[model samples]
Target: MSSYDFVVIGSGPAGRRAAIQAAKLKKSVLVIDDRGSVGGVSVHTGTIPSKTLRESVLNLTGWRERQFYNRRSTDNPQTNCAALNSRLSKTLLHEVDILEQQFARNNVHTLQGRATFVDKNTLRVERREADRTAVELVTAERVLVTVGTKPFRPDNIPFNNRTVLDSDAIVSDLTIPKSLTVIGAGVIGIEYATIFSALDVPVTLVEPRDSFLDFVDREVISNFTQQLLDRGMSIRLGCSAESIVLDENDWPVVTLSDGRVVRSEMLLFAAGRKGATDDLGLENLSLEADHRGRLEVNPKTMQTKVDNIYAAGDVIGFPSLASTSMEQGRIAACHAFNAPMPDAPHHFPYGIYAVPEISTIGYSEEEAKAKGLLFECGVARLRETSRGHIMGLQSGILKCLFELKTGKLLGVHVVGEGATELVHVGQAVLNLGGGIDFFMENTFNYPTLAEAYKIAALDAWNRMAHERSGKVIKLKKRKVGKKAA
Candidate 1:
């Protein structure tokens, strides 16, 4: 029997982060993972693998370089299954090694097995693979569960991993289908559909909902939708698969609710994912997971029904990016150990690694409108900047919203090259209560995408000027503090 101050289940972003945080606080920490590896699904199957495949496809096919050379050849990249996933395995191994070293440096112990609650403070570890026949029990003063989720596979969808595949299969047992029919236009489905499309494989994206990614600013979605359409991807919204069956040749023939039959060489069902909590024996703790296998917790503390236990990451649901999960894990660790937690940031950026990247932070246009905030928008296209020309870029937009009364920055939305990395500038200013004056007054480096910030600021400045009877819009003067770097 082993006892520790903290025990974290599922070595994903959340669990690993929590374990390390607890160990750093001078507490004995043990991390348990059933995957038999340090990095959870994010490294082995989820975020990293998918993003790796996207980058690999982009690089090998000269996706960014296409504008400079033979567009036809680069547009239709030739690749096989082995070459596509060759770097993926290596990347996962490297990530795992880094995580393992971190744990070692922090003196955080790790156990490999399935973890189930024997009681609120007791956990039974079934180490079947680690040792042919060993069962280990560990006791914890506090616990964190971050098992993450698995792809939702409806009974009607035949997930054979050959013709019909789930999210996991897209990374493992992957084969380039002659054509692909991706059901569910969520982040995962959209990502896979576009990845294959980049490979010149025809893709038909079907979503039951009339709108997908409703959280994103509609304008960004509009731009992204146009990019997809321009690239020859078929988007069928408000359409669901009525039936999915295999034909004589083992291809998936999908019949839609609208009475159209779409037969594709492969089908990817990435509609949604449910938390992996069913086998965790939560009944012992009187903790009931929702229908989706997600646990409800206090957003501030990450505490569940049990005072000594906490839940974070995808298991707690919504905004389930690996980045957010890590934050949630750290918050849980701080609460568990009664450590002084840092003040929460004003907003977190959302990054979608689709063909043309889309990243956003702060209130979206829709959100601002719904809140009835007095706001004005500024816009800049990437082609409007010198760097866009140097990069041979085709399309990208940066939009920023500012309150009409105050010069406070509301939101920043971007679509195209380095959108994910470009969003942090907005995040920092927004959190620091900075305003458009910062962008207008500050100088950005020449020949850079970052200059789009200054460009967008000027656009808003001009709009504000025009709206106010051609009078200059000046922010109210106040006591000034030192500026942020």
Candidate 2:
């Protein structure tokens, strides 16, 4: 038996952060992962893999250069599947090496095995080496579960991994698919669909929901949809896949509930992901996970039903982002050690790494309306900016929402090139409670995307002033007419 101050299960963003934070406080920490690698899903399969592939495709195919130069100068066979896969392999290797060094330098111990709960404070880990299996018992004063999530696989779908694939498997088994069909219009589906579309592959996106990314600002979604259509991607909304059959060529033929048929060279099912917790044996602690295998925790402290045990990352659900999960793990570790938790801002940014990307922070226009708050919105198209012209961008938008009565900035939403990076400027202002005056007074560098903030702010200011002045003019006209009569 081995004992430690903190034992974190799963080495995803949340688990890694928690283990390292606890170790930095001089507490002994041990991280156990079934994969035997330090960089969890985020590094191995999810975020890193997808984003790196997006970049590789863009660079290898000269996506940006083709905008200025002709396609003849950019298109080549070197940007094919083999080259893209090679780039993904190189990037993953580099990331894994860095993570391993970090864990070693922090003096955190790692074990390779599947972990199951023996009790509230004890875990039984099963290790398989060659033809032999071994069991070890480990106890810790505090335990954190951050196993993350996996793609949901329904029994009805025949996932042979040859013609059909899920979100996780597609990254590893990628080929230069001639035509692709993607199910679901969530973040993952839209991202992959657009990425392949950029490669000039015909992509059909099917979603059961009528609206795409309803949580995002409608205007931003509208622009995104238009861009997808302009790129020759087919979108079928309010349509569900009734069945998928393989044709004579082993290609996937999908039948929609609406009686539409889509034939493609390959199919990707990315409808949703469920928490990875079935092997954790929560029943021993009398804890029950939800239908999706998610555990509930106190929002503020991230403590599970048991006092010493905590849950973070995708296992706890909602806003399951690598950026946010890292913070949750750090905070959970702080509360476990009775240390002061750092003050976190109320608002956090969300970034989707699709082609022409999308990112936002704070309220959406619909959210402000649902709350019944008097607010106004200002928008600036990327085409209006000098940087947009230089980059040959035809479509992009930056939107700002502000409280009508107070003039305080409430939200910032963006869609287009560098949308993820440009959003921080608005995020800073929103978090600091800065109003229209902040952007008006600030001097942004000329000929940059950041200038969109200044343009958006001015648009809002003009509208507000026009409304106020119109009201005052009406009052003056009434007084003059009364006096003359």
Candidate 3:
């Protein structure tokens, strides 16, 4: 039996970060994962893989280059699936190497094994080796579980990794289908749908709900929908998949509940994510997980119901992003070691790396309205900016919500190229409680997309002035004008 100051299960973003933090605090830390490598889901299948695919599509298609070329520029700029797969795999492996080195530098032990609770303060780790029986070990004083989540697929659909794919298997493919049917319009599904569309693959996106990404601002989603349609992506909303069967050629024929059948060369199920909690032996710790096998934790401290344990990332639920997860992991470690824990960022950006991108931070328009707060809205169209027009931006918009009375900025939402990066400016303002007046008094350089922010502020100012003057005129007109007429 071996022991450590801290043990983190799953070498994903959260687990690795926590282990490193604990080690930095001069504590013996061990990170155990079932995968042979580190970097976990984020590097393997979730964020990095998806973004790499998006970049590959953009580059191969010369989508951005088309802005400067004639529409008749018929050069396809050919790229094979093998090339993409090779590049992505190489890049991911390199990243994992760097992560491994980071752990090594921090003196954090990396174990390739599966871990489960044996008691409140004990974990059983089973390691596998070639042509050998599994080796078992007991380790850890305190544990942090950051196992992440797995793609969810309906029971009716056959998840034959070759033809029918989930999020994990989708990225490992070296080929693009002629036609693909994507179930679910969540982030993962939306990303792949757009990537395939950009690659000239016909895609039919099916979502049972009328809307997707309900947490995001409605205006942003509306803009995304238009962008998807403009790119030749077909969407079927409020439609459920009744069944999926193979055609004569072994292609997928997806039947929707509305009696509509969609035939495609490939099928992708991206409904949602289920917690990676199976086989963890939570019962040993006297703990149980939810329906999705996700554990609940303290939002601030990230400690589970069991005091000596903590959980973070997707396994802990909403806003399960790599950036947030890393911070959560560090915080959990700090708290566990009784070290000084810094305050979490007052405002964090939510970035959706879809085609053209979408990002937001701070309050939503509905949230402000529901509070009955007096507000003004500022909107900037990408087409109005010289940079946007030069970039061949057909559709891009930035909107800012402000408290009318106090002139304080409430929220910012952006949809367009580099929108994810651009939203940080607004995030800084909102976090500092700065108002539209800041943009009003500042200059954002000529011909830049950032100028749109200032332009939008002016737009709102004009509307507000007009409303105020109009009200004043109405009040005077109702006073009889002292018989001047």
Tell me the deviation in Å of residue 347 in model 2: 1.0
The runs of at least 3 residues in candidate 2 whose Cα sits more than 4 Å from the true structure, single-residue gaps closed, are 72-79, 467-485
Model 1: per-residue lDDT, tens digit, 95-160? Answer: 999999999999999998899999989999988754485889999999999999998877878888
Residue 264 Cα positional deviation in candidate 1, in Å, after optimal superposition: 0.7
Candidate 3 regions off by >4 Å?
70-78, 466-485
Evaluated against the true structure, the overall lDDT of model 2 is 0.88
Residue 230, candidate 2: C-alpha displacement in angstroms: 0.7
125-195, model 2: which lDDT tens digit per residue? 99999999999999999999999999999998889887899999999867868899999999999999988
Clash pairs for candidate 3: none
Measured on C-alpha atoms, candidate 1 has an lDDT of 0.89
lDDT of each: 0.89, 0.88, 0.84
Per-residue lDDT of 160 in model 2: 85
Candidate number achieving the greatest TM-score relative to the actual structure: 1
Model 3 per-residue lDDT tens digits across residues 346-401: 77888888887888887778778888988888888887788888888878899999
- Predict model 3's lDDT versus the native: 0.84
Worst 10 residues of 1 by lDDT: 476-485
Error of 2 at 193 (Å): 0.4
Model 2: ten consecutive residues of lowest lDDT: 476-485
